[model samples]
Every structure is written in structure tokens, then in C-alpha cells.
Target: MTTTDAAAAQSTAEEREALRQMAAEFTRREIAPHLQEWEDAGALPRELHVKAGRAGLLGVSFPEAVGGSGGDLLDTVALQEGMFSQGASSGLMSALFTNGIACPHIAAHGSSELVDRWVRPTLAGELIGSLGITEPGGGSDVGNIATTAVRDGEEWVINGSKTFITSGTRADFVTTAVRTGGPGAGGVSLIVVPTDTPGFSVDRKLAKMGWHSSDTAELSYVDVRVPVGNLVGDENAGFWYIAEQFVVERMALAIHGYGIAERSLELTVDYCRQRSTFGEPLIKRQVVRHKLVEMRRQVEAAKAYTHAVAAQYVAAGGPNEAVIAAACMAKETACNTATYVTDQAVQLHGGTGYMHGTEVERHYRDARLLPIGGGATEVLTDLAAKLLGYTR
Candidate 1:
């Protein structure tokens, strides 16, 4: 969904530059030094969140009214761009900035109490929040939630399960999609259930081929209950709430796709300049030079297209066909770039890229998930097609 900040857009180039530098420096000092260790540990420490919150990095794109640093989506784009440029991985971004997904709904449409209880602290990095939408049996089907939330006299009793939840193992609460009315799309509603609530449990810490540093969890909500006042907006509006949020997710993942692709290209470029192939630097060969040019071309196109979509989406002030279609297209474009460029990065690095500890190697594995995460490219493509009237 488009999160509108009442605070003026921090749209100035200079502000973005400053934000970029801050993000870059933060990554260099806090993240770069220990990324490998965290990846090995399969999760980031909570202390990192506290540090980032203290630094105001956690709230860059959120409004000051809600404890954010008071900027728009462009500021977020700039921040992530800088981090990725400084070798931050997609997994790290997901784990650290889960608030990007978790808090926007509260910040936008939730009650004052909800904002105070969850959004503010989350943006401030004191508390971690997660979005629980993908159930064990279905993803990309917001209308088909199996989770049920029955309203008691003063509480919402929730029962169902969520999987592939980012930061689920560490979250203070999950802004969950639950069924409250009849069956299907019209029945769904969003309710914030604190992780410590009765019957709420992290069933398992999932192991993944990528995003290892970001803890993914299988969560069970067996009679989890929260205050009835925890409902976000009206009951049975969860489908629209979740659907809009998914668009923003697509936009975020687009940034992730191109951001990592650009970083991988830079790393590969430096390696090519130093590594000798057949007794000559790889950059000296025509084929290698051509490959580098193609990689740069893809990265540039993806970045440009994604940025344009973000701008248009922001300018639209709310959802529009152009905005939605562009968001979908941008994600597909950037995801394609990430996969292609990361593969080439590994190919160019030859044996070195295949090594476990190599930066490009990690990116190679991480890039494989961009198309699959957020929304699968195939699914988004069809949505975009329908929006663009490309479907019968």
C-alpha cells in the first residue's frame, strides 16, 4: 500500500544524499563487519535493532508523528540503495526493516492506541513487528485465509498458522490477517496479536537456502487472543488492506533486486580488474568487457524503471492502474536483472564466486529468491496484465 506521510516529503536530492551516506556508513560500521557471522548464526541480534533505532535509521521513511524520521518512500529507496551499495544483503534488509511491512498499516489506518502500542516502538526499533499473511496452505491468496478470529466480549480469539514470516521468531507482535465474517475475501480482517499471547508460538525456525541471516518462522496461533480494540480499521476489510500492502512489498523487493544486482556488478567489476585469466586481466578481454557492459545495462535499466515507478506511485497519492501496473512491471524487471546479473557475477568470478565465503556467492544464492518473494513474478505479471487490459 502507499503510505502517505503527513510530514513533507524529504524529496530534496541533498537530503537523500545525506540519508544515503548515513545508510552506507551505518552498514560499513554495524552490518558489514559481522554479516558473515550473523549469516552463520541464522539471525541478527536484537542489539542491532536498538542501535539502528538509536541512530534514527529505523524510521527514515516513516512520519515523525509515528516516531519515524519523517520522510517519504523516496527516502526509503535512497536508504536501501546506499545500504546495498555498501554490500548489505537482501536478507539483512528484510530482517532489519521488517517494520517496512509490519507498521505501515498501523501508521496509516490504525487507531491512535495501535500506533502508540506498536507502530511507534517498532519504527523506533525498540520492538520488532511482523506481518503474518501467508498461511501454511496458501500464499498470494489474501482472500482465502484459513485463520479465524472470533470476537469475544472484549477480545479477538485467533486460530490458524503462518509460515515464511520474516522476523517471526523475534517479533513482539504480528499484524495478522484473520477471518471474522463469512467465507472468502469479504470475511477477512487484520488484528494485531502479540507474540506472547496465549497459544501463540513459533512452531519452528525454518532453514532456507537464502536469507539465512533473516529468521523465517512457522507460527501457530492456536486460540491466540488480543484485545478487540486491536483491530485495524473495520472488520472484513483485511483483503484490501493486505492487497494494497502487497503492492508496496513488490516495490520494496524491486529495490532489493536492483540494489543487490548493482552491488554484485560492482564487486564483479573489481574482481575482474584484479583477477588474471589466461595471464591477462579479465577486463582486458573483449568478451568480458562486453559482459560487464551488458550487466551494467541491466542494472541501470532496472534501477531507473523501479525509481520511476516509485515516483509515479508516490505522485498518484493513492492507488491507480498506472501505479499498480508499474509497480508490478518494475519488480519483474528488477528481479530478472538480479537473477541474470548474479549468475553472470558468479560465472565471471569462476571458481572464486562459487566459494562459500565469497560475497558474490552469497548474492548469487540470495538473488534466487527475489522473483519468488514478495509476489512471484508469474503472479504479478498476470495481475499487471489484467490492470493493463492485456488480458481478455
Candidate 2:
């Protein structure tokens, strides 16, 4: 279908519900069963991406001409929420949605050749791609990245290392941020580095406290040569692109944060109702009941604020700095709330929640990454302050 036609279809409530139901079924069938095994293995099977692609869940927000469903931000948000609500793990979502981070650069700025070669195949799930921006020394500081891409005759020699890369080990291509000019954000640019290219190596898959199935990695580029044509956008213009994209990245992290909290709350409620303490159901205790009530309140509040910010973003048809600030605030709110909810869920579960395989246990570990990932809570708060012109 044409982009306009698909978008028109998604504008209706019926179409949106159909898409959400499809995503829900796909998550239950493909993701729910294997989550524990995948979590233990520290990486999901790549086939899940192919399955999700076939179900039309992978391309909901892209243009139809590029093999997408041509839906807007809300449709994508619904798909994300539905998958999580249907028991898809946060690790699976991060690995599966790595394309959301990788494809945008090519779609927005790459040459037609790059788009045809990488973006289309990735959206089709024929290949996996990831974004590499956070470096070993420059966590959440894009401007100070130390990776250098020096131009040669027809190629750029790349030499740098990236750490904390989501889906890094299994990625077929990496949209890498590199320093092409001088120090700082103004000198940075993005380049597509194919895994097969010489001097590009997966240094080591880093073990983490959570999101085990997502395959975080440390990547090393030692004199890797990439065609100059692989440059995304103008040379030395990558900082602006990366900065602009942070809003969506932060929003995605926010969704994961709150979605996991909501799921944890649901499970906790069921557990509380069934398990008794002091000769009554645990939930009958005033303290336990109040804790559950607080958890529900936080999740609902976070969801509402996130939805409002996302709606404003979609209606504007582009990134508004204010909306971006709002998204950051929502992310911080959700992450903190999720932390509280998950911790309380664990407390409510007592020993059961402490078990390794319990859903709440997984959530408690996974929730730790929310404030640290996308951007640290401190960094985001500082950014928010700066955006509001709040200076000491």
C-alpha cells in the first residue's frame, strides 16, 4: 500500500486496534515462551526479528515506500506497550527494536545507495543493525566521542572503540558515530560500518546486571576502511543529527521503563491477592494495599504524561525542543516510578520475588537500567534545567 493510504487506514480506531491486536498475538507467540531461556543465554535468537518483521510489527512507523506500515508515533507506541503487556521481556524489546536506533540515520540522511543496501533490508528483517554512539570514555556525551574517521582517497579509515552498544554482537551493520574533524560535537559525523569490513571486531560482549538478552558489547575499530559514501549527512554534522534523535531514543526508554513497571504491578497484584500472610491475603494488609495503590498511581501518571508528550510530538510533525524536554522529564519520572514499583513488588513477593526466574525478579534487575540508559538521570535533569534556563 501507498504511504498515504496506509497512514489514512491507521488514522481510524479500528485500524489501530487491529494493529495492536496483531502485535499482541505476535509477542505472545514469539517472545513470551523463549524469554527466560534467552535471558539466561544473554542474547535473543535473531529469528525473532524475522518473525516480528513478517508480522508487520518491525516497520509500523516508517514510510510504506521503504517497506513500512506508514503508521505514526502513536501506533508505534501502542505496539511497544502491547508487546510488553503481553509478556514480552524488556531484553527482547531492546534487541528487536535496535532497528529503531539504526535505521533512522540512513533513512534521514544517507545516499539512496545506502538506504537500498542497509535500511530496506533491515526494515525487512533480512539484516540486523545497531547504533554506536556511547564510547568507553564519553558516556552520554556525544560531542566528546574519541572515535576518529580520517578520509583517504575513496575511503575513511576508522579507529575507535564503542562500549555499551545494544545488539552490538549480532548487528550486521552499525551506524557509528565518529570524530571526523576536531574535538567536540561540531566535528562529529556518523558512518555505517559493516561487520564484514576489516578491522571491525566485536571486542567483547559485556555482561550486565540486566537486559541480558539484548547483547551489549564493546566494539573495536582498528584502521577499518569504509567508503566515503557511507557517511551519513554532511561530514561533521552528525552531532546535530544525534542530538535531534535523542528525543525519540529517550521516549523509547521511557516506554520501556513504565511498561515494565505496569507489568510488575499487574503481577504483584495477582500475587498479593493469592498469597496470604498473618492469616489473611497479603493485599489485605493496610501497608501492602497502600503500596499497591501507590504503584498504580505512579504507573498511570507516567503513562498519561508520556502519551501527552508523544501526542504533541506527532502533531508537530517534527521535534519541538519543548516536547523533547517534556519527553526527558517523562523518562525521568517513569524511571524513578518504575524503580519504586519494582522494588515494592519484590518486597511484596518476599522470597518468591527474590528467586532468579520470577518475573518480578527479572523486572527488579531490568528496572535498574532505566535511569542509567538512554541517558543518566543526572544528565537528563541537567539538560532539562538548561532547557528551562534554570541556572544557579
Candidate No. with top lDDT: 1
Q: What 10-residue stretch in candidate 1 is worst by lDDT? A: 1-10
lDDT values, one for every candidate? 0.90, 0.89
lDDT by residue for model 1 (1-392), tens: 23443233433777899989999999999999999999999999999999999988889878788898888777889999999999999999999999989988888879999999999888777899999999988887778889999988999999999999999999999999899999899999999999989899999999998988999999999988789999999989888887777777889899999999999999999999999978999999999999999999999999999888888877887568888888999999999999999999999999989998789999988989999998888988999999999887
TM-score of model number 1: 0.96
Q: State every prediction's TM-score relative to the real structure.
A: 0.96, 0.96
Model 1 gets an lDDT of 0.90
The local distance difference test score of model 2 is 0.89
